[model samples]
Target: MMKVLLTGGAGYIGSHVAVSLAAAGHDIVCFDNLSNSRAAVIEHVEAITGQPVPLVVGDIRDRDAVRGAITDHGANAVIHFAGLKAVGESVADPMKYYDNNVRGTLSLIEAMVDCDVRTLVFSSSATVYGEPQYLPLDEAHPTAVTNPYGRTKLMIEEMLSDIAAADPAWRIAVLRYFNPVGAHDSGLIGEDPNGVPNNLMPFISRVAAGRLPELAVFGDDYATPDGTGVRDYIHVDDLAEGHVAALDRIRAQDDALSVWNLGTGQGYSVLDMISAFERINNVRVPHRVGPRRPGDVASCYASPDRARDELGWEAKRDLDAMCASTWRFERTAAMRNA
Candidate 1:
């Protein structure tokens, strides 16, 4: 029965993790700036959990606001997810990523320290591994980030490590995620990005829903079987549960800092994902193959063995489940908006 504060609780992954945490009998407070998300997400989460979650409309870069949220709710732990995401955006404006992802994390931790809430589960990305040196990237893989987005994540990881080393009282778990797709089974809450989505799954969903014209298959000439970039697309629900699992482990153990990769340990090319979505949902997704984007990798997946062994968590949903749920949510959202 931990009282947790989710920094970006109204966002896609944060909302799902909020539901998961509530189901696990934990109280949660969502602190978000609503920059890339909507306030209606808090209502949607309430609908899913049948429990009220406090929404604090604030930025993580504001230490006073963060501290107030933690102190006001008496939160015992923090799941830091308030940060800008999107590789192209990060590259176009590297300063924004540094200010939000890196500086925002520093501010959040400072607030946590002030509030004496040391347990944290950070949302990191596998992009830190960069262009994979080996297949099934493990935690020990050398981090040579290729883009500003990846650099921000790696910088935060290093910062957290240094912090935990300086103060053993701080318990932190960094989960490096692969691609997270799909939606909740209820179809009530899913990835609803503003404007053009930067990720593959949401972009595909929009294209299938007729909101977008076609999906751009970036880098079809990559050195893969299908000549497209391959990624490990874990279901969003599974990723949410992984956060809960990491939270549980950090709370139970005295380990100052722990890092785990949250992924399916399997690779799916861009074509493979498109084909799966079409086959599973019986829908056509119009797509066009364009030249490879800069800083794109040929293949990237995860080992996921550390999370399995340490946290006893593994992605359970299959590719079909991911596609079906995503399509279901897309249709449901379209109808509701109409």
Candidate 2:
């Protein structure tokens, strides 16, 4: 098993990936700043895996701390998930996004080079695709990000490409995730975004749990089948498994930079998702039609062919499972918080 250092490992996707890696018998060191996540998540991860994951509390931008964590843990690989992710927030403060996302990645890469650990699995987003030039976005789709959040992902992808080109020893996997939803089946941890959530599934969860009054169905006039925006929402566990698959593939390769989309290749409209949540959970989600936010797309999903054919991985969970798991987590988290 590989010794992997997970940056932002206490966060939603990071924590799930940590659990997956630990379950697969990998030694995991969780490094996080705790800026947007809680330290208690590490406890949940340990509880789920029945294995203690060492926590290194530090910022990714701190080169010394990053290097120390890598060297101290004897980490053979790094999974980068530390960054600002909100598109609206990124637009409001572009500098913050660039500094944390771009500069932070630079620091981590420098530390990796210093420690001679080259294998990397980067947490990228479909936002890098920007306004989808076509449906079922493939890795070959031209990248033209709309917001600063997306721009940072695109910039990091480019940076990794350049680094790989310069040094043949670097092995990188840029997993462009479409729309990651759901939580672990244990319902021990899930998406716990600070303040209001920017994504759809969490918002629906909150509304269903009565933490929020209602959901906002943005842009009902879009040209989708239901006139609402559509997205490919994959289960977080499935996405985490994709990371494990990526780590295995990258470890086997000598020198390669691979890009794959982790998604279901199926699009579900906003109303469709809400209906699924309500039907599955037997809860009413009061929602109203709202104006389309800036930089919002009508429909966005993934091709998922390359990841399937190459990495021997495909999303196995369906939409109903995603909704039910998220609602379960939301209720569990709410009770714990209470």
Candidate 3:
């Protein structure tokens, strides 16, 4: 098992991945700024894993802090997940995305180079593919991102590619996720974004829980089965397991840089998701159709052939599980807050 340093371990996906990594017997140290996360997530992760997860409260943009975390923990590999992820927010504040996502990644890379931590698993998004030229986007799809959020992810991908080409010692795996939803089966940790959420599952959960007045169904004019946007929503736990597989794959290789899409290889429209959630949980998620959000596409899913053939990983959770786990976590979180 690898001694890994998780850059955004207190956040949604990072925390889940932390549990998965621990289950795989890897030691972890979480380095987070607590910007988009809370300290209590570390405790939840520990409770689920029954292991102590050391947390280093520091910004990824701070090279010294990052290096110190690595050396202090004797981490040989890094899972980079700390970044601003809201697409609309990125469009509204391009500079913030650039500074936080792009610059922060650069600092992390430099620290890794200085410390000789060559193995890295980067958290990327499907937005880097831009508006799909075809259904089920593959890694070979042309990359022309439409928003600053995608641009930042693509920039980091290019940077990693360059670094890998320059030095053969770096073993980097870029897992471009489609859409992550749901929670851990334990319901001890889940996607609990700060303030207003930028993702769909949380919005639906809030609407169902009466925390939000209504869900904003962004655009019904898209050329899809239901006149709504379609995406491949893989459960967050499955996404987390994919990271563990990626880390294992890269470590076995002498030197490598690879990209894989972590998705379920199935598409679900917005309406379809709402229907499934309501049917599974017996709850009404009130929603209203609005104009399409900027940087959104008509249809975007993943082929998942590469990830399956290469990493031996595929998302296994069904839509019912996604909806059920989300509602379970929502109720659990509500009780905790109460």
lDDT of each: 0.93, 0.94, 0.95
**How would you encode candidate 2's per-residue C-alpha lDDT over 11-76 as one tens digit per residue?**
999999999998888999999999889999999999999988899999999999999999999999
**Preferred candidate (TM-score higher): 2 or 3:** 3
How does model 3 fare in lDDT? Answer: 0.95
Q: Tens digit of lDDT per residue, candidate 3, span 191-241?
A: 999998999999999999999999999999999988999999999999999
TM-score of each: 0.99, 0.98, 0.99
Sorted on lDDT, highest at the top, how do the candidates line up?
3, 2, 1
Residues 190-237 of candidate 1 have per-residue lDDT tens digits of 999888999999898899888899999887777899899999999999
Clashing pairs in 2: none
How high is the lDDT of residue 61 in model 1?
93
Off by over 4 Å in 1: none
Minimum summed lDDT over a 10-residue window in model 3 is located at 250-259
